[model samples]
Target: MSKVKIAVIGCGSIAQHRHLPEYAMNEHVEIVAVCDIVEERVNKVASEYGVIAYTNYEELLADPEIEAVSVCTPNYLHAPISIAALEAGKHVLCEKPMATSSEEAMNMIEAAKKSNKKLMIGHNQRFVASHQKARKLIEDGELGKIYSFRTAFGHGGPEGWSVDGKESWFFKKNEAFIGAMGDLGVHKTDLLRFLLGEEFVEVGAFIETSAKENADVDDTAVCILRTESGIIGTLAASWSYVSKEDNSTVIYGEKAILRLEEDPVHNLILQYKNGEVVKCELGGIQTNEEGGQTTSHVISHFVQSIISDTIPPVPGEEGMKSLQVILAALESKETSKIITIN
Candidate 1:
């Protein structure tokens, strides 16, 4: 098979760290171009990869040889750029919080259907080694009759990770829509859905902008989520972990309790009711901290799905389902009532 000619639509930190590098590592991928509103960033990335650079995404999409693209732009641009790329006969791998609203997400899905192209969202949490193993164990009845869980993803802030630092689009409501919840919370929601293999039916949340100054969006959020099977859990996303990052989940079940990313050496641990403790040294998850840049496996999976003409692991419909939970959480925060998913 010929290499899949690809382009990255935004030369942001995610594009620089994850998408661009991962795509280059894939033997079946050929990066044809890069696009970003910032000419310097785009040019630097294109030069590093020996590819063409364009400041306009529409112009980049006009190239007939580009087979796919990774949309690493701000949250507000995910749906529109992904929809346009799909309509232009190209596969799309858009970043998380796929859209600002459920309607936009649905529109992107419809566009993909109309174009008959694969649309994968960049929900990398589902691709983590520990997460995948946890899902498999639950599926194999290792943790029989799951009861509750507490999952959190928090860090110092995006100021350290994003290209623009403190002034990044992440703090701007017009660009990011929601702050920590959209940036980090959605990943936990998607992962919980994947691990439990059920949909979240209700949400009650408290979202606040208590941490970061000069930021109009929330910096911390805590949500109560109930799955369709009546399994309830707490999900927390924050940008105020000053000293270290916390990306961990603990699940309780009738047979045993499962812990993911909780211990430094052991990525997964299970303690049974009969005094048996099992520790698995699965690989660490990717994080913003030093020495945490492990392979995400998202780019490779997206590339393989396109090459094999198969559905991606996290398709647009799946992304929309996970996104709806966040949307419901927002509504719950506003109305001070438990919001039910339709």
Candidate 2:
């Protein structure tokens, strides 16, 4: 049982926080290399992990020992880095907002298909215990004919979380390519689709930069989404929750209303039409309150999928579909019309 040798491209916040630590913790993985345009950061991470340091991603991807890579770079670079990794015969675990565009996402997918390598996207919300259980209950007919869902992911902006605070790449349109929609919204979009087992077919959005002084990117956004089965909902993503975050979802059904990631103690609460209530304690998601201490199952899942020769739960295609919803919402915002997913 040889370990999967993996490298992480981009030694930024996410790489330092999730990919580097999680891969180091995985028994089936060996963090063999790390790359970042910033030499100091790359050297720091590689030296800490006792691995090779590469200032260029191309150089890092050249290693024959590296079986996979985690692309934790900015939004604009996800597609190119992922495509190069796949072409170099390496599996890729690209960060959320798989690409800046659906077309770019599709290119990444094509590269994976041609390479026959696993291309997982870092949409780890699907691994949340409460969300997973809710999906199961819905599928098991406990919820009964889900009508709508309202999901939101917001915080006090990326200033507190990003490595560079307010001046981070997150607020730069050229670097980020998007703001909260791609950062936080895509996570919810993917999670909602995963939970309800449906695709968003239409979108209407109101995106704005109402907060975050000097930041050109949208600090807040609200999108109206309709799924393939006519299930409609509002998806909100914002960095303007100055006090606390509201990373919660409520699903309405004919028989019950399921609340996810809302309650402090329960984590999930369900109230039936007959007045019966059930509270379930579930695993927490990585959030500002926790300073992201909770474990994300993404690394383990990627390793296990490779070991088992199976597809990842959040494959590139799945990520692309979810990303498309966000893309549509962006178009809707710009055009002032309901955009249909093609």
Once fitted onto the true fold, the runs of candidate 1 whose alpha carbons sit more than 4 angstroms away are none
Q: For every candidate structure, what is the RMSD over all alpha carbons to the true structure, in angstroms?
A: 0.7, 1.0
Q: Tell me the number of clashing residue pairs for each predicted model.
A: 0, 0
Candidate 1 local lDDT, 183-285, one digit each (tens)? 9999999999999999999999999998899689989999999998999999999998888899999999999999999998899999998989999998889
Reference-based lDDT, each prediction: 0.95, 0.91
Question: Largest lDDT belongs to which candidate?
Answer: 1
- Tell me, by TM-score, which candidate is best: 1
lDDT of 1: 0.95
Question: What's model 2's lDDT at 30?
Answer: 88
Worst 10-residue stretch by lDDT in candidate 2?
285-294
